[model samples]
Target: MLKLVMMNDALRNGDAHLKNFGLVYDDVMRPRLSPVYDVLTTQVWFPQEVPALAMQKTDPRGTEKWLDQLELERLASLSHCHNVDIVQMQAQCREIALQSMATTLDECPKCPPRKALEHALKIIEGALPVPSSSAKT
Candidate 1:
């Protein structure tokens, strides 16, 4: 779940509200998160758009639309995740988003959508942090 939040943030998915998530029951009747869908980089189209829901613990008023590194750590704490997990998830999400966007950009034709995707890719790559060389080792 935290990973989903990280992924959406990295990809600038502004429409990722509670309604976007679904639950499925397995054969043993245990509930599990359904595969994610309806992902969009609404931020590119609506630059002023904010996250559909606030994940910050400090934002009692839910006014914190955009999340920063500190807020991400707070969110992980609220979600009962170890701090290390959030750090790892951030790096993983960054890599996945960059790879996905690069592949899409290559296959995309030379057009406006491609332009928007290129812009989105730049935003995504810039927003998320890469793990340090020391950390990678």
Candidate 2:
């Protein structure tokens, strides 16, 4: 769920790739989702693409709104791909994700992207509980 949100932001910001992500494992040998990897691309890559979208914009606010709408669309597709409820799971995940990204960017200055993702994973871990140790055993 969190990964979908981060990926939505990444797609919105135009940073899509595996290098942007990492994974961790739990006691039950399951993989855990990481925070946001490769976010710097937004700062590094977004400006070049902006002028194209900007020209289509009749109103200044349209550009920002367009990005938000794009994010939501991507979230829906992603949710479907994962076989989850788009509105209930993805929407809620995106809301939590926005907050997670804001908090990571603010408090974790100089934190490595992997580290940031680890933090984000921790946050979502509670919301989407992992399989229990007993279940795994």
Candidate 3:
């Protein structure tokens, strides 16, 4: 899941952070990937207190310099490559998050976190299908 997010162009831009991830555990106490949360786009907002740099008029390259100085390789890669599919995945993740927010409760007394996770699992289970070839004939 970390790898997926690392490769994701939308997340690469600036959204990847500790707040965006979570974890879940099964009945037998096995930990697994949890529903994504707090997914959003981020932009480099230049500080109002800082003065903008002056560069040569013919070679105005402040943006490139800023990006390099800030180590924004992830953003650079996404901007330079074919990231349409990653964008689609990010959209799907956002939809899932919206659906969860609209329908899920913040707290459930009966089953607590486990039951809530089960509910989320049901929502995404269709995406993971059993292999037909492995089924008993």
Top-TM-score candidate index: 1
Q: Give each model a TM-score.
A: 0.82, 0.33, 0.28
Candidate 1 backbone collisions, by pair: none
Candidate 2, overall lDDT?
A: 0.46
Cα RMSD for predicted model 3: 14.9
lDDT agreement of model 1 with the native: 0.80
Clashing pairs in 3: none
* Each prediction's whole-model lDDT (CA): 0.80, 0.46, 0.38
* Candidate 3 global lDDT: 0.38
Per-residue lDDT over 1-137 for candidate 3, one digit per residue giving the tens place of the 0 to 100 score: 62335222222224445554567877558787787665432222211111122212223443422122113234435457434443344445534543553355444435555544454444333222233443467
In model 2, the clashing pairs are 35-117
- Model 2 per-residue lDDT tens digits across residues 4-120: 443344334344445545677765588877765544324233334321222123355666332344354455564575554434444455455556766777787777785645544
Model 2 lowest lDDT segment of ten: 49-58
Reference-based lDDT, residue 91, model 2? 44
Error of 3 at 108 (Å): 33
The RMSD of every model to the true structure, in order and in angstroms, is 2.6, 12.5, 14.9
